[model samples]
Target: MFIYQKLRDSILKRQLAPGNQLVESVISDKLNVGRTPIRGAIRKLAEEGLVNVIPNRGAFVIQPTKEEIVQAYEIRMELEQLAARLAVPYMDETDYEHMQRLCDEEGETIQSSDFRAYLQVNKDFHMTYIRKCANMFLIEFAERMIDQTNIYLMLYEMVFFHTSPQTAPGAAEHRELIQIFRDRNEELAGMKVRSHIANAMKSLQIDNIQFSNLGDIF
Candidate 1:
């Protein structure tokens, strides 16, 4: 489990990079484990859409298409908006403070050019609020969608406009979003979340020159 998490984290952080091949024997040797465990881990990642297993080509990181990226963000926009609406009445001071801390941490990561760390912290911050809705079904649904979208983001990040290396603006957006939540302004929160997703999609469309063919992957 630890090896799986470490490998997944490395992929998400881009430390492994897109299109990188994952050779089970090599990984087993490097991690000082048997091929059985490494193979199991790779299979798990493949199921999660993190790794692609070609019939004869071996395992590699999945590269997302432009359409897939757009679709993923669109789903995220809807789900997150719904989550914010559901969570507004349930949010307390503790949630607000924790969100603020997550924003600060994300800011630090972004400033340090640690995009992977920022992505993880950003997801954590969002999940923290979404979990407060206390609706298991909705929470699970939103989490899955976010997971898919994050994978898309990792795969096609360059397709979007250059993400700012600076953490201040991203942190500011997080802070503002939190303030909206604190005010119990569900409508504004939904709008902000939608806009944030839309901006991200727009950036990707303008920057990345490649378009993913959904049919090819499916």
Candidate 2:
């Protein structure tokens, strides 16, 4: 899990950008681990949709296409809306406070002009609430989808749009959604979640960009 998290973080932070060939030997040497563990970690990440494995070729980071982004965001929208609907009835004041703090932290990160930190915090904020939905299956499913979506955003979405400026609006939306949750308005929460996803899709336009899949790096 640690290795996978480290490698995934590197990819998400663009430290290991798309198309970078992942050499298992090199990674094992760097992390001072045996080939077996690194290989296992790679397989786990692949299952999480963070890496692509080609039969004879080596593994490589996924270079998301516009179409892939659209599909990811659409799926995220549906799943998140469902999560929010389920979460509302079970939400507590503590959860609300934690979400509020997350929003504030996100806002601060955005204002500080730290895009990487802001992105991490934004993800944290979403996960914090999404977990409260109390549906392990749904939470796990949404997490995987979100991870895939992040890969798309990190690799391709920023190429076409200025993602930094959108952070503030995204943070604001989180705040609004939290407020709706606090009010126990499941309907409004659902609507807000849908709107947030729609707005993100429109802003990112993952379906319009051109990308060529460099078939099976690994």
Candidate 3:
């Protein structure tokens, strides 16, 4: 898990640029771990849609396409809305407090222009409610979908936020949704989730701006 998290954090932090190849031996030597664990961690990342392991070529960080981003968000909207609706009945005061704290943290990130931090906090905020759905399979699937979108979010961080400084992804909508959750209005909560997803999708400016080559070393 430590190896996996190290690799994952590196990718998310843009330390390992998109399309950078993950060399097992280099990573194993640097981390002082065996090649077997490195290989396993890479496979785990591939399963999470963070890495692409080709048959002959090595695993590379994912560079999501415009179409792929759109499709992922579409699926995410449905999954998350359903999650919010199902979670309304299960949410407690503690969940609301945690989510609100995430929201506050998210606001701070925007002020600091730290979009990456905002992305992580945003994920936590959504997961707070999504986990309460009480459906293990749904939670797992939703988490994967969310993780996939987050990759795109990180990939296009500058283009998504800097180009339009006014667009703060879900900063306000998240707080509003928290209130909807507190109201225990399942349908309203679902609607707010749908709207939040749509707003976030609208903020993104998708293009063929490549960040790195797959031939690049990690």
Q: Which candidate is the best by TM-score?
A: 1
Evaluation by TM-score, superior candidate among 1 and 3: 1
lDDT of 1 by residue, 1-218 (tens): 87678778777645665666777766665667887777788899999899999988898877666677777788889988888888899999999999988977876776566766767898898899899877898899889887787676665565222444353445667888999998999889888878877865664432434433211221
For every model shown, what is its TM-score relative to the native structure?
A: 0.73, 0.69, 0.72
Model 1: how far residue 29 lies from native, Å? 12
Residue clash pairs of candidate 3: none
Candidate 3 residues 1-218, lDDT tens each?
88888888777656676777888877776777798888999999998788999889988888777787899999999999999999999999999999989878887787777877777888899899999999998899999888878778776555434532245556767888989999999999999999888777776554534443322324
Over 4 Å off, model 1: 1-41, 158-168, 205-218
Better of 2 and 3 by TM-score: 3
lDDT comparing candidate 2 with the true structure: 0.73
Q: Locate the minimum summed-lDDT window of 10 residues in model 1.
A: 209-218
User: In model 1, what are the clashing residue pairs, if there are any?
Assistant: 65-212, 66-212, 159-208, 160-203, 160-204, 161-203
Model 3: worst 10 consecutive residues (lDDT sum) = 208-217
Largest lDDT belongs to which candidate?
3
Flag regions of model 2 displaced more than 4 Å: 1-17, 20-50, 157-167, 205-218
Off by over 4 Å in 3: 1-48, 163-169, 208-218
Clashes of each: 6, 6, 0
As a whole number from 0 to 100, the lDDT of residue 108 in candidate 3 is 79
